[model samples]
Target: MKTTSSLSRILILVSALLMVSAYFTPLWQISLWAPQYPEGLNMKIWIDRLSGDVDIINGVNHYIGMKHIGQEMFPELQYLVYVFGAIIAFGVLAAILAKRWALYTYLLLLLILGLGVLVDMYLWGYDYGHNLDPSAAIKVPGMAYQPPLIGYKELLNFLAYSGPDTGGWILGASVLLAGLASFREFRAK
Candidate 1:
């Protein structure tokens, strides 16, 4: 009979709870630093909203003609919370089923979700960076201000860094925990 160890089930449940907690934390953050603004500007992206120095960031972006970084710009915000809720539910069901197949399916879903998020972020960055207005105040002959997806980049005089926030770290740990559970179940089989 196909089965999952009790420990594996516990791990899956724990991961699910951790993901739920991520709903209350910032999932991603983008920061910008320049000589004029020694303090740096930060924008934190939550599951359903944005926080931190958004207004300031928008004001700065205005000079370069980048689209305003606002909640209205991201339709995903309207339904992303529901998507995560469903993923968490899948995890809970996987734990309750206590079957190797269920755990593997949950792991697969997590992988897909992670990849999809990265692709989406990259696309958004591309559009924002490439779609500059002809009437912008600052225009480099062939420069695009696309920020790094997961690291540091220099754009003009500013240093931009993009990476996961507290919630992202928790979610990453949760994914790893789930992976461990999957590996254990695979070994048991």
Candidate 2:
């Protein structure tokens, strides 16, 4: 009978546990700073909702013609909970089954899901930044307010910083652990 390595099993289990953190913590965060508001405005994006200064952010966005920020606006919020649950379930199964292919499949799915999220976020940002209403109050002749995918961007006087938050880092660590397990498994074979 073939058996999986103890390290691989442990890593998969740990990864599964870490993924649970995503549900409770914000996955991404964007902060805007200007001279007028020294403390800055923050927006946290979770798998299912938005938090932190949402009303203020929406008010500012209105002038620039960006869509009002709201949980109802995101369709993904409806299904992401189930998706993460499934990922966690699959990770646990992969560990318990101790099958190489099972772990590989989980890792592959995780990678695809991760990429999909980035694409979705970019599209969302693109739509908000580019589809400005003709009558917007704060129109710059050729300016778009698209937030950076993973860094800093300047929108007029505001400096926007975008990056993965705590949950995002956890998810990333989960993936890394899974990857390391896969690598070790492959090397052992």
Candidate 3:
């Protein structure tokens, strides 16, 4: 029979690969698919495409300051970082806690994470423009999108603390994998 440690090692490798794959996706872009809730796409890539426009930065600033414009899409860049942090944390913590209790906890975390994101996205998907007459443009329908927490010091504080300690869990998982593998060698007995 395959040993517990051997299986754990393999699982750890698989988890790492899955996270890396998610990292390269255009989670930053909004599309017909992920533009709104339940199942939605990222919107940041869509903004990146317009980064070359001479007016984009000025436009983004206006929106962050609460100006009513489709340009509200910019500050949402914060979510890209948020989701990345979530994925890394869940992947490492759940992967390391691959034991019975840890397994359930990990699954619960996944379900909660997915639902949280879906709900958040759904609210964001509301589009007043879609239903309005041609001449009347409208703001989106959901929670008024707000400027992300701002200022240099505040931003740095979030990146360091609010971003989640995934790095710690990632290292912990790696060390556990190596230690477990070494302690319970996978060679044929």
Candidate 4:
């Protein structure tokens, strides 16, 4: 029983570390590294250079949108949903199982921050992806409308510092707290 308790604590601690480390390392960087933009523009660029089609207009924005997300300032990405979801799931479990107020506090903070991030991302998508109807384009011609996949960029960057360490620290800390809570729960059992 003691071993189980200790093991649960260890597991919870590990979970916390993973969730928290995610903030610093940002697992999404996995998506960022050699980001796959829409239609693989890097490859296209290479092919175009070879074929001398560089001047020929391409669906650059759409291609860019589909290929990678982080390069553009305020890039629209729906992927944030998954991140936020993970955060929430961890937070909720911690909240229900955790007896400590500090853990609850972390959960609250996650909720608040998570909601703000979600809203911002949704709006970014709404603004960036709004392609107009062809008929509307003829009459109310305006900025080219982007599809949803290419439009929603998550916007919860820490105001203090936008670097990996800054955001990662906060996110990591949150995960750590969550893991602690889970460990505590397991320990209780």
Candidate 5:
């Protein structure tokens, strides 16, 4: 088996360490603006919790029949930390082994994990927006208030924006580093 270069191993270790910081920062953010609240309302999605104007956002969402926004609503938060921990551990193991195949496998895992996250978020948003209470106070026929996945969306009177947060950027960087490491290793021969 071909061995990865020392630099590739170092990069893999660094990528694993970078992923650790994701646990300490918010992974995603959503902001809402409306005529009633020009100041805007924001929500930050942390690894295991939610922050920012959660109560206010929930109150607004209630009028539209959307479920209350709460940490308890997201069961994924319970195991997200462990999932990342396992991925990071795998990266470390790949680095220690210093094998090209292992590094490539780590890179593939990162890509799949990233894609899975996006898909999961999209599905959650779809369910949250589409499954409205029948007796909602402000029901508009055939209207679903799904927030944009990565940009701005006008939901009734509210302008909603969704995007990655600090932790997300760090995770992207880790993936980039891992990819670079894999590329370097592949070309080393």
Candidate 6:
């Protein structure tokens, strides 16, 4: 009987633990700056909710015709916790099994899930920015307020910066650990 290396199993288990952090930390953040507010404003996105100056941000978004953001507005928030739980479960199972194939499959699924998250966020941003209400207080014929998917962008006078936050960093580290484990496994074969 062939057995997987101890290091691979340990790494997979560690990855599972790191994924749990996603539940409590904000996964992404957007910061806004304009001449009026030199201190800047921030919005945090989590799996199941939004935080950090959301009311202020929503007030600002109203002028640009973006829909008011609330937890009820995002259906994904209701289901994403389960998805993260499943990923964590899978990682734990792979670690316990200590099988080479199991580890590889788990890593691949995790990677695909991560990419899906990015795409979903982009789609949400696109809709929020492009789908403006016709009767908004302020109207600029062709202006859109789409926040950057993963970087900085200028949305009129506001400079917006979007990137991964605490949970995101943990997710990234989990992915990195899985990758390193895969690399080691492949080399051993």
Minimal lDDT window, size 10, model 2 = 1-10
Give per-residue CA lDDT, model 1, range 1-189, as digits (tens): 587899999999998889986689999999999998899999998999999999998899888989988898888889989989998999999999998888999989888988988899999999998898889997888899898999999988999999999999999988999999999888776
lDDT of 4 at 129: 42
> Each candidate's TM vs. the true structure?
0.97, 0.97, 0.40, 0.36, 0.96, 0.95
- Writing each residue's lDDT as its tens digit, candidate 2 over 8-75 gives 99999998889999889999998999898789999999989999988998988899888888988789
Off by over 4 Å in 3: 1-9, 28-76, 79-83, 127-189
Q: Give the range of the ten consecutive residues with the poorest summed lDDT in model 1.
A: 15-24
Regions of candidate 2 where Cα sits further than 4 Å from its true position: none
Per-residue error for 38 in candidate 1, Å, reads 0.9
**For model 4, the run of ten residues with the poorest summed lDDT:** 43-52
Over 4 Å off, model 4: 1-16, 23-59, 62-99, 131-189
Best by lDDT: 5
Rank by TM-score (best first): 1, 2, 5, 6, 3, 4
Pairs in clash, predicted candidate 6:
none
Q: Which lDDT value does model 3 have at 123?
A: 44
Where does the lowest 10-residue lDDT sum fall in candidate 3?
A: 155-164
Pick by TM-score: 1 or 2, better one: 1
Off by over 4 Å in 1: none
Identify the leading candidate in terms of TM-score. 1
Report the C-alpha displacement of residue 10, candidate 2, in angstroms: 0.5
Overall lDDT per candidate, in order of appearance: 0.91, 0.91, 0.38, 0.38, 0.93, 0.91
Of the pair 5 and 6, which is ahead by TM-score?
A: 5
Name the better of 2 and 5 by TM-score: 2
lDDT tens digits by residue: candidate 5, 97-136? 9988889999998999899989988998999999999899
Candidate 3 lDDT, tens digit per residue, 1-189?
223354654664454444443334332222112112224222233212222222442333243233333445445554545655565576566555544344334445444654564455444433321222333233334423322211111111111011112332343354454345434443423
Give candidate 6's TM-score.
0.95
